[model samples]
Target: MDDADRIQAASKFLLQSPPGEINDVLNDVRNIISDDDSLQAGVLPALREYNLAQFITADVPGHQHQSIVSDAARVPSGSSDEDDEQSQDRYWDPRSRTSFRFDHLTLETSDPEHVEPDSESEPFRVALENAALAYLASHYHDGVVSVFSTPGSASRFTIQIVANKYNPNNFWSGRWRSEYVVDTGAKQVTGRILLNVHYYEQGNVQLSSTHSLALALPPAIAPGGGAAAATKVLALVEAEEGRYQASLNDTYAEMGEKTFKGLRRALPMTRSKLDWDKVLGYKLGAELTNSKAGFSAA
Candidate 1:
């Protein structure tokens, strides 16, 4: 097909093609165009249309228009001096903003020891649980994690974590434990920590909880060339994983030290004659002993 015909075909494909069909059209046009400049020019309009479709279908309404205007302003122009000035002014114009709010973490544990019958233990346990939740949320925000979750009444969030295969074994291996301290007497404790996945969604405000863990992974990574698009996807994915790892790590650390210390401190004077050095020494020794065993086996 001639350049004009090819452009028209591409435009039509962009307008009516199902997502699965776009790749076929792209491939066909790519094969037909011989010149580098013509091929790039031919694909530009179609790409813009695809981006517009994505923006419109995004969570925020009218995002497509905002994206288009932002993109137009950034296109460096070698036209007249007046045009360059106009482009600069347009780039600075305020566009519609999309707001996001992250909710507190929802705890789900599998440890029966952490579940308590005493009313006094409830608040402390809840506080520890919520603290873990908040830590995870903050981590997600910082890591630029991507998360996808179901949207119906029963939907839950699932976050993805990517790790390099070459990283140290310690990078991927760690036990997470979260516990609530009750009275120092009887050595009683209640709480559970299960090795489970986490999911997060943007713009979701519901505070309810669910029992199931369902996760759907995105089929491809590095799918877009646009800087903004790439950043958003990476951020979402990293944030989700960061939240999970932080929650798990923080909980485990708190349970080992603060929770144990609080319980020890709450004991009766006679029993409170605790040996801090012995307690910490024994804990650290146990961890080292375990690590040695694993290393030896390896």
Candidate 2:
């Protein structure tokens, strides 16, 4: 097809395409018009459209879709045993692995019975939610946070951070969902953080932990004190959030370094490592030759 026709044809697919498939279309276009700078320029709009498509396809309503094409494209190559070992090691790195998320924050009253805050506390509750949203917007990078509160029940709120990835060909899968439920009364915030990590691939490992956290809110913000109150609330919650985020980050590192290792050994427990050359020579072992698990077999 001519350049205009090709660009037109490509835009149709690109606009409707999901995040995974966008790169495919772009690659095809580049291959077809490698030397044509002007043609590439014409295609920029379609590429921009792909950016918008991600936000449209995000799993959570308010979240921005994070494209994993670049990460997934980093498939390990070369036939050396050392390269294979290095690749395996890289797989366990938490950042590269497709896992874990800060799901949401559930709010509760300070009462012993753990009921929702009183409706009269609307001003304070809103102040809290606004502070949280601001904190998340600035601090969290991978996902977006949103607030969900019922009309009459102004005291109860569910502030959530949603992020997800879906690629059938990816080796790593599953989710580590973490949520915090805290009491909104008083500056000394106390709450429980719940974690549930369930991995579908790489030995189907699962890990979980629940713990309580407390932080003293920053000074200067008083309950129902309007804008000034909101600013102080932001700092207060930000401190608590920093702590909560630190806990989750530490847990992820532990999962990669210790928890996952204990569950699945990359190498057998023997003193000497198995000879990969011999194993790859066998028919079944031939499949291992392909860095990816199912790709070579298929």
Which predicted model would earn the best TM-score?
A: 2
lDDT of 1 by residue, 1-298 (tens): 6787867675666554332234545666665665657765665555544533322111223333211222321223446775343333222111222221111011111111111122433333233323333444654332111222212211122222211111122222211222221111222222222232221233212111112222222333221222332333334434544565577578779878887677665666676556776998979999999999999999
lDDT of 2 by residue, 1-298 (tens): 7878876776676665433445655666666565566655666555544442232211312223231211211223345674342232111111112221211111111111112334565566566556766666786554543333333443333333434344446533222222333234444544444443444455644445555666565554455565566566456555665676797799789978997788876777885678877774665656666546667567
Q: Whole-model lDDT for model 2 versus the true structure? A: 0.45
Regions of candidate 1 where Cα sits further than 4 Å from its true position:
20-24, 56-298
> What lDDT is reached at residue 61 by model 2?
20
Off-target runs (Cα >4 Å) in candidate 2 are 1-120, 141-185, 247-271, 274-298
lDDT score, candidate 2, position 235: 68
Q: How does residue 118 of candidate 2 score in lDDT?
A: 44
What TM-score does structure 1 among the candidates reach? 0.22
The lDDT per prediction is 0.35, 0.45
